[model samples]
Target chain A: MVFTTAVNFIRARGPDELWRKRRIFKLAAHFIGRKRNCYSIAVRYVHRALVYATKGRKLKKLDMKDLWETRIIAGVNEHDIDYRTFRESLYRSDILLNRKVLADLAAWEPYTFKALTDVAKRRAIDDGLASINNEHKVDGIITRGALTKS
Target chain B: MSALKRVQQWATFARIWHIYDATWQNPFKSAEVVKKFLMGLYKPIYHPLNDCGDHVIIINSGEIALPGDEWKKRVYFHHTGYPGGASWTLAWELHTKDPTMILKKAIYNSMDGNLQRRHTMQRLHIFPDANVPKSLLDNVSNQIRQLRPVPTRLDRYTAEEVASYPKLIDYPKDYIIR
Candidate 1:
C-alpha cells in the first residue's frame, strides 16, 4: 500500500499492532469473562500473568533449595550430625556434592547417605571441628593430620 | 495396562512393614531414624503431600539407653487445665510408668508437628519388649538397622569365652578378686 501524502503515512498505524494484540489475546484465552475476547481488559490481565510467571520461576528455585535443605537436615540428623557440620566436613574432605544431589541420595539411597555421614564424621574428627564430639570415634579413616601426628 | 505393569504399579504403592530393634539404643537418636521410615523420606517418590509412609514396629523399647543423665534431668510437663494442676514428671518416672512411653514420646516429638503427624504416628507400633503380636510380626518384611552397635556386657559373655580372652597383663598374685 502506498501513502498519498506525508500526513496519510504519518496517520497510518503499522500492521504490528494486530499481531501484538493477537499475542496478548492468545495468552488470555484461558482467562475467565470478557478478558479472553476484549483487547483492553485482556492485555492488562495478560501482562500481570506474565509478571507472575517471571517471579514464579525465581521462587521455584528458592522453594526447592529450602526443601533440599530440610531433607538434608533430616537425613544427617538421623546419623547424629547437624546439617552445617555435615556439609562443612564434606567440603573439607573434597567431597563437593551439592544440596540437590545430597538430598536425592539421602532419600532414594539411604545406605549411601549413611556412608556419606560416616565419612563426614571422620573428616570432622580429623579436622577437630568444634561441633563434633571428641568421644565419638570412627575407625578405618586415616587423615593427613593423623599421619603427620605419628 | 498390561498385567505386568499393573503388578508393578501395585508394588510401587504397596505399604511395607519394617521392624526396628531398640535395644541399648538412644531413644532420641533412634527416633530420627524411625521418623524417616514413618514419613517415607527414604522413598524416591516421597512428597510432603503424598501418603507414602510405611509401618514401623519398634521392639525392645524397654531397654532403650539414655545418654548422660537424661533419665533424671529430662522433665515432661503436663497440665490438667485447672488452676495449679500442672505437674512435671522425670524421664525415669515416666519410663517406670510405661516402658514404651519414653520411646513413643521421642518418636512423636521427632516428627514435625502437623496434621499429618497424628496419622503417621498411627502407623507406628511400639512394643516394650520383643513380644510383638504374631499378626503384626508376620507383616514385617524389612528390618531397620540400629544406629549404633549394642555392646555386650561382661555378664553376657560366657565363662569359657571370658577365660579365653587374651590379656595384656596378668593381675598380681596378691590382688584380691572382686
Candidate 2:
C-alpha cells in the first residue's frame, strides 16, 4: 500500500496530473479492503489518500489564478506599461475587462492592447485628468475660449 | 491511441451493449429505489472503491415528480469555515443555479466522500433539459428514446389522499345493522 501510494504521488506530478491525483483510486482501495474485512490497513491508507486528493482539488483554483496573473504581467510588459500602473489606470478609467479576458488579449493580440491604451489616454484627456507639461500655452488657449464664449 | 482512449472506447461499447429502458403502468415508488436508480447506486458492479461505471444522463431533472412535500422540507447545509458562517441553501435555489447539482449533491452525500467515491461520481452526468447536446448524447444515442413512462408517482400517495380516506369509526351504524 505504501509503495502504491508513493508511485501514485510520483505519477501525479506528470502532465496528465489531474487524472493521477484523482480520488477514485483511494476510494476504491478503501472500499475493496473494507469489503474483504481483513484488509483494514488498506482501508486506512485509502482514507488518508482521499484527504490529500480533496486538498489538491481545492488548490487547483489558486494555481490557475497564479498562471493567469503571470500571463497578464507578461502581456502588460510587452505593451510598455508597468503591470500595477496599467491595472490602476484601467480601473481609474472604468475599463471593465476581467483578468481572464485581459490575459487572453495579451497573449493573442497586440494591436487590441495598443487600442485599449489609446482609449484610456483619450478618456484621460477628455476628462481633464491628464496633467499638462506646458501650463502657460494651455492656459492661454483656455482663456481665449472663455473670451470667445463671452 | 492512448491507454485512456482505448479504455474509454471499450467502456462506451460495453455501456451501449447493456442499456435498457422499462416501464410499469403502475409501480411502487420508494425513496430507496429512486435514490439508487438516480445515483446509479444499485448496479452489482457498483464499486465504492473505483469510478468504473457508465455515465448516467438524467433527462427532465426539473420535471422529476416528487412523492411528497420533500422539496420544501428537505434542506442542505454547508459551512464557509468561519464562526457563525454555517449557511443553509434550499434545494429549490440549488436547482436554479445548476439543476444537475441537486441530484449530484444527493449522490455525493450517499457515496460518502472518499477518494474512490469521487472518481465514480465524475462518470455520472445530469442535464436539466430534455434535449442534451449531440456531443453528450452521442454516447447514449443507442439507448435514447422518449421515456414517457406514464409519469410514475415518486411516492405512493399524496397527503390529501391519505387524509381523505374514511376511518372504520366514520362508517354509519345503521349501514352496519342492515
Q: Highest lDDT: which candidate? A: 1
Error of 1 at A101 (Å): 8.4
Candidate 2 DockQ, CA atoms: 0.01
Error (Å) of candidate 2 at residue B66 is 2.6
Q: Model 1 chain A: which ten-residue window has the lowest total lDDT? A: A134-143
Q: Give the Cα-based TM-score of candidate 1 against the true structure.
A: 0.60
Docking class of 2: incorrect
In candidate 1, how many Å is residue B73 off? 0.8
Off by over 4 Å in 1: A1-60, A68-150, B1-10
Cα lDDT tens digits, model 2, A1-150, are 244566577755454544543443545543553432433454456667779889989897777666566566655544444556556667776888877777666645544665555554343334444341122121122333334433
What are the per-model DockQ values? 0.08, 0.01
Interface RMSD (Å), each candidate?
6.5, 20.4
Interface RMSD against the true structure, candidate 1: 6.5
Please tell me which predicted candidate would have the highest DockQ against the true structure. 1
Which runs in model 2 stand beyond 4 Å of their true positions?
Answer: A1-150, B1-51, B141-148, B152-178
Error of 2 at B61 (Å): 1.2
